[model samples]
Structure formats: structure tokens, C-alpha cells
Target: MSQITISNAKKIYHDTPVIENLNVTIPDGTLFTLLGPSGCGKTTLLRMIAGFNSIEGGDFFFGENRINQMEPSKRNIGMVFQNYAIFPHLTVKENVAFGLKQRKLSKQELEERVDKYLKLMQIDQFRDRKPENLSGGQQQRVALARALAISPDVLLMDEPLSNLDAKLRIDMRQAIKEIQKEVGITTVYVTHDQEEAMAISDQIAVMYLGEIQQIGKPKELYHRPSNEFVATFIGRTNMIPAQLLHKDGQAYIRLSDGHMIAYPALNHLEDQDVRISVRPEEFVRSVDGPIQATIKDSTYLGLNTEYIVETGFAGRIQVTEESTLDEDFGPGDIIRLEINAQKMNVFSADGKVNLLEVI
Candidate 1:
């Protein structure tokens, strides 16, 4: 296991900046995810760490060693790509032993390492099968085994499970998580899938347009987002235009709907146009509340029913409730909506100030 530190790293593509003055520290033995939409430089950043791409500016280091000048093979990093990248003609055992062969290991040592990783990944039974004869999940396991057989200090995965079916992806995610924990290798995984990142990462960095918007644990990013982009991108949220009414000693700000919402104040300014971000699961359907809304639509998502409520004061608010949310409100049903004041977040119109910062 090793710690990775990137300081003021920048990258460019044809005069266009891909990463801008980026700085991030991935803790040793932790699974850190770089998450964002496509063209956000996540893959570019991963390539930089893997030594597949050059560092245009700043420094990249693994522990105390400066690795920017190192070759990809010398970086001691295992990479699992989106494509399985398995040899069609080679059996699983041969594929896993490829790296060991590169090091010129003796036959006995090669066989020992190959058998170890195959059993570790639970694909030993497929040792004699070629890539064409294995399932997608089995193929992914073989690819992982091949990467691990190299015994790299850090593992880099670039959307390794993107090619699998949803169910297989889930199973593979669990398998990967277990393997990572068992081996205790520091891992850097890049993916556009928010759920996958949230599921396995010890820390997640939300990137946008070559810049990191926020980096924190999944729950922190979800519950207390630093900006509108992080709040909207991390999970489902109802962003409503609101006016800063006033503040108390506790930094409680009133909204345009004449409701006082208590939250951590980010700035000292009294009056400003603020956008309040409330998660869909934070609203409660009520008979009498500060605001009245009409149910515009409802969606049953098995575990929960999502309500699109059109408020007279606040546009459309998405309210998510468990299937047992007591009462059901169909379309056109006039209902009172209750917002959880403590659980809501407020940000500037540009979505910079975290409401938690003010109070």
C-alpha cells in the first residue's frame, strides 16, 4: 500500500486545459474514486497517475518517490482497463502468468503465483478456459487476477466493470471491494457511475471540467454539498430560488415562502439571492404546513415513491418517500409540504457558498 500525492497538477489537450491546478491526496490502502461526467478529465487524470500520460505541470508522487519521470512499467502500478484486454488464444492461467513471465520467474514460482491469484479471485476452475469460453464476470476476474499477479503497490481501475451487465457489475463490485480489502492495496478507480463510486470508495472526488469540485466521503458530499454542482450531481435534490430573510444567533435564515429554515451559515451577508437545496427524501407530506403544493406527478420506484409537487411559491419540488409513507397523494392532489429545516442546504446563486459554512 502507498499514498499518492498530486500537487498543482495540470494537463492540456490542443491548447485546451484538461486539468487545472489540481491537488489531491489519496490515502494509503484506501479506495479513492475520481467521479464525474465524460470529458471531465477523470480518465485523463487516471492516465497521468498510471504513467500513461505525461504531467504537463506540477508534481506527481507515490510516497516520497517522484514518479512523474518513471516509465509505466516501473511505476509498480496495476491497471485494469474498461476492456478486459484478455488474449483470445491464451488460457486463463497463461494470461495471469504473463506478468510473472516478464520478470523471468522460474517455472515453479510462476505456477505458484498464478495458482494463488486464481484462487484468490475464485477463478481457478476456469484456469484451462480461454477468454472466449468464459462469461463476462469470469473474464473480468481473470483480468483482475492478471493485474494482481504483478504485485503492484497501487491498483488503478478505469471503469473496469463498465462492460458487464448491471447484475454482474454489482457482483463484481462486491468482489472487487473484498479483494481490495483483503490485499490492502491502495486503489484509484475512475468512473462516471455515481452509485458505484458511492458504494466502494473511502473517499470520492467530484470533478468537473478538469477541476475538482469537492472531495470527501460519500455521505458528506450527499448530506452537505459544497456547491450546487456537487449537490445536484451527488444525488437527487430540489433546488428552489429563495431570499435570505434574516438571521438569528444560530444563523437561521428565512425563505421567500415565509418559513424560517435553520442551517449553518456560510457567509455573513444578511440579504442575498440564495438557492436552497433540499434532497427529495427530506420533505414530508403533511396536512398543514408552511407551504401548500399540488401533486403534479408521482413515480413508484419500488422502494420509494417520488412526488413532483408544484408549489405556488417554489416551482417544482421533488419529494421522495418510502412506500410506507402513510398516505399516498396522486396527481392533482392539493397537499401541504413540509421541509426539514435542519437537513436543508443553502448556497449562493452561483452555488458556491455551502449553507453549512455560514451558521
Candidate 2:
């Protein structure tokens, strides 16, 4: 296993910049994910790390060795593509032994290693089945087994779960996590699904427009986003415009409904307009509070009921409450919303800086 590091990584295509001045560190034996929307440069970055794409300027290293000039075959990396590229003509055992053939291992050793990975991936029962006869999930398992049979120092996956069904995707992601843990391989995964990345990654780098917006743990990015983009992208949040007020030594936010909510006093935002981000589950239903709204819509989702409440001060905000609540809210029902100041994230009006840090 090795820690992959990229310093000042740059990629340009047809005179247009894709990735510029990129730098990140992937620790040894951890699963890191590059997450973003389509065309966000995530796949490009993954290809760069795999030595499939040209790195115009920067350094790529695996542990202590610089691999910028290294050939893809010499990188000793295993890749799992989105399509699970297993040969249709080859059986599961043969597919898994493909990489071992290149190494010229003894016949007994090759069979042993192939058998080991097939069992590890739990596809030993289907070892004789061809890719055409197996299910999507089974084919994916074959691909995974084949990749691991090589004992790669780094495993790179490019949306490996995209082709599977929703339920299978969940199951495969769990399996992938367990297998990565068992093998202790440094893995870099790329995906556009936020929940998938959160469920499987040790660390996630949120990319946008060829640049990293933020890099942190899933919960850290979800709970305390660095900027508005991170706040809205990582999860659902309501961004409300408010004015920062300072009375005596205390700082408060004044809503448009003539209600003031107390907040931590920060010297930088004494009397300036700001935006407040509150998660759907963070808003509490109350009889009396600084926020008042009318239910515009409600969705029953078994575990929790989602409410779209329209407030005079905050426009429309989503609130999620447990379905166990005795009182059920419906459309056009007048309701009061209350938010905990500590749980709320305040950002500058332009949505660039997080004011919560100053507080």
C-alpha cells in the first residue's frame, strides 16, 4: 500500500484548463473519493492519477517515488471501470487469472491466487460462469476479484457502481468497503452520488469547475460547510437572508418579520447582512419562535415527514420532522419554526465566508 500525493497538478485540453494547481494527499490504506457533478473534472483527475491522462505540470507520487513519467503498466495500479469490463468469453476464474498470467506465476500459484480472490469477493461459486451468464452484481464481483488478484498498491475505481440497480449499488458499496478494509489497499473512488461517497469514503474531495471546493470527512463537510456551495452541495439546506445585529455585547440576527434571534457575538459581522443555512432536520416545530410560516407542501417518507414551509421572512424553507409526532401538518396550515442558533451556520451575504468560524 502507498500514500498517493499530487502537487500543483495541472491538466489542459485544447487550450482550455481542466485541472489547475491541484494538490491533495491520500493516506495509505484509506478509501478516498472524488465527488462532484458530471463534467466537474472528477473523472479527469482520476485518470491523471492512474497515469492514463497526461499531467501537463505538477508532481505525482506513490509513497516516496515520483510517478509522473512512469508508464501506466509500471504504476502497479488496478482499475475498476464503470462498466465492469470483464471479458464475456472468459470464465470468472480465467478473468481473475488474467493479470497473473502477465506476471508468469507458476501454474499452482496462479490458481491459488485466483481462488483466494474469488473466495474473498464471494464469487467462488460462479467461478466457471462467463460474464454473459452472470448478473450485473456478479459481473462486478468478477471485475473486483480480477483487480485484487494482481495485488495492486493502489486501487482506482471510476463510478464502479453506476451500472448496478439501486439496491445492488448499496450492497456492492458495502462489500467494496469491507473488501478494501480487509485488503488494506489505498483506494481512490470517483462518483457523483453524494450519499454513495459519504457511505464509502474515509475522506471526500468535493470538486467543481476543475478545482477542489473542500476536502474533509463526510460529516464535517455535511455539518459545517466552509462556504455556500459546499453547504448546498453536500446536503439539503435552507439559505435565508438576515441582518446581523449587535445590541450591547450580544450579537443577534434580525429577520424580516421583526423577529430577532440571538447568536454568538462576532466582531467581524457586527451590523452586516448575512445568509443563514439551516438543515431541514434542524428546524424544530414550535408554537412560538422567531420564525413563522405556512405549510406549502408535506411529504410523508416513513421515517420522517418533510415540510416545505413558506415564511414571510425566509421565503421557503424545508423542515423534516419525525413521523412519530402526534400532530400532523398539512398544506396551508399555519406553523411556527424555531432554529437553534448553535446549529445554524451563518455565511456572508455573498456566500463566500462562513461567519460561524468568527463566532
Candidate 3:
């Protein structure tokens, strides 16, 4: 019942507009993430949704109730901040029970609710301990437990896992996905980490320069980004300058390396300058491939090997492939490569529009 709908949202800071004419809807009981770089206004939009920031000119609603002017406390939202904002002075049980007690729940109800969430978040063993005594992961669990103990319609998390260690961050992200599914609360999460957003989000809204650039599932964003910014921002991609040519009623792209490849989809467009977005994995190291390059260096990670290669026409570009026991191409080793045109993206010269139709 907590499907969030935003319409023509606007936010301004000191007469400078931070967000303008934004519209998005978050489905009920789904984990929606706002993802972008630090200064892209993801946090600003999140604050607007939580009723902490005044909406300059827009309608914000949870379900059918307009909450644009409502008090933050009255909006029935549970927010877990980046700092793990649990009280250091209070024990875990008291911290979990704090929100319930604010609603004037009876003693038995508050105690049961506290125990339930403490058990749900698996932090019951630390019930009698204060925040200062808990590790970062444990403290984060306490914060999540306290937030859920209130049984709010919506949960807002702003970089909740950023403080945990690398391993704990992975563990906690899985825990959050499971817990969110169990509770079925409509949650809006905000983070700058693309991998974290891909791991946990049901749908992600990628923002930039005070505007939402794209919104889609993780795979959709990765495979079929709407523009140059979205394609580059969501994952690692090499932008290669290329030329679009139509010959014999067929479409072909001449890459910077002077290697031309046919892409049937581009036949409709006129011959012009274009940019090709190639992910590292899209490059195949074929013995007879057209493009020739010399490897400048190689980093052999366990699963894959990444190479920085210098090409005659394309300058230096990155390529990734699976590590093989017998193949070890070192610095100065020449290799031939080809792009997987079926999977590659072609964009306008200005990088504003992706030429390939969404499949």
C-alpha cells in the first residue's frame, strides 16, 4: 500500500535549483535505489522524499496521501542513515524499542516488538549491550532493527552499508535483500556505489546534474543504457571514435583502428561520425581479428585478466578476458581483437542519444 508517486518534483538550494521537474514512481514492497555520483543530487532527492527537505514545486505522495507538507515524523517512515544513527547511550533492546514507545505502545507490545526485530536482524545476543560496544556491522544491524521495529510503511536508507568493511558490506547487503523481501515494505535506498546498487536494487534511478538520467533493472542499465552518460556511469566502457557508413544497403562502422564491422541496425542512419561503447568483455582476442594491438600491461585477477593495449588508431584501450592456464600475453605482445557488434552500443557523436533500438 506504500507505492510512492512523485510528480514534477523540484528542489532549490539558495536560489540555485538542485532538482527540477522530476517524476518517478516506486512500486510497493520493492527495493528502489537512487544511484549516482556524490554531487548528482541523489541524496537531495531522497531527502525530499523523506519530507526532510521542502519540495520547491512538486507533489509527493505515499499511496493516496500527499505528504509534501507533512512532518517527517508523521509520514510513518523509518530512516537508517549512513552513520548508523542508533543511540550510544541506549542498549540494543532499548534502541529497538524507542520508536514503538514513541507511539505509546503498551509495555508487552513494545517488548515483543523489540524482541521480534532483534531476532529478525539477528542482533538479540547484543540486546543488553550499547552501540559503543558493538562492531560496525553489529551497530548497523541494530540500526536496521530499530528502524523495522516501528513497522513503518516506507524505509529510507541513505548509504547504510558504506561504513562496514568490505566483507561485511557484502554480507550485510545480502541480509538487507532478504530482510526487505520478508517485511514487504516499500524501501528507497540511496548509494553512490554501482556494484552495491546492482546487487540489491529491484530498480535503480541513475541521477546526474540534478536530473535522473535513467531508471531500470540492473541488467537493463548495464546492457542497454539510454545515453552515453548512463552507459559510462553504470559500468566500465571504452568510448571509441568511429564512423558510420552505408554501403550496398548495409550498415558498417569503421573503428578508430581502421577495422570496419557491419551492424545491420545502423542502416537507417545517415553516414556520420559516431562513438562506439565497448565493454571490456565485448572484445574477443581472436588470432585473425582485424584490429591489431600491443599489450602495454596485464593484470591477472583470478577470474579474468585485464589488459591495457596500445593500438595504431584507437590509442590505448582496456580489454578483459578469462584467464587461461596456457595463455599469458605479456607486455609488448601483439594481439588481434574484434568487437561483438551484437552487444556493443553505438551513440551519437555528442553522446546524448544511443542509436541502437532497445531490444
Q: Name the candidate that leads on TM-score.
A: 3
Q: Give the per-residue lDDT digits (tens) of candidate 3, residues 1-359.
A: 39999999999999999899999999999999999999999999889988889899999999999999899999999999999988989999999988998999999888889989999999989999989899999999999998999999999999999988899999999999999999999999999999999999999999999999889999999998889999899889999889999889999999765678999987888899988899999989998988888999999999999999988766778999999999999999999998888889999999888888634
Ranking by lDDT: 3, 2, 1
Off by over 4 Å in 3: none
Compared with the true structure, what per-residue lDDT tens digits does model 1 show for residues 317-350?
8889888666677999997768887688889877
TM-score of every prediction relative to native = 0.95, 0.97, 0.98
Q: How close is candidate 3 to the true structure, as a TM-score?
A: 0.98
How many backbone collisions does model 3 have? 0
Candidate 3, residue 209: how far the Cα is off, in Å: 0.5
> Relative to the true structure, how large is the alpha-carbon lDDT of every model?
0.88, 0.91, 0.92
lDDT of candidate 2 over 256-343, digit per residue (tens): 7767888864544668998989899898988776577889999999999999988877668899989976778789899887887767
Clashing pairs in 3: none
> Cα deviation in Å at residue 164, candidate 2?
1.2
What 10-residue stretch in candidate 1 is worst by lDDT?
Answer: 245-254
Best-fitting candidate, scored by lDDT: 3
Off by over 4 Å in 2: 265-268
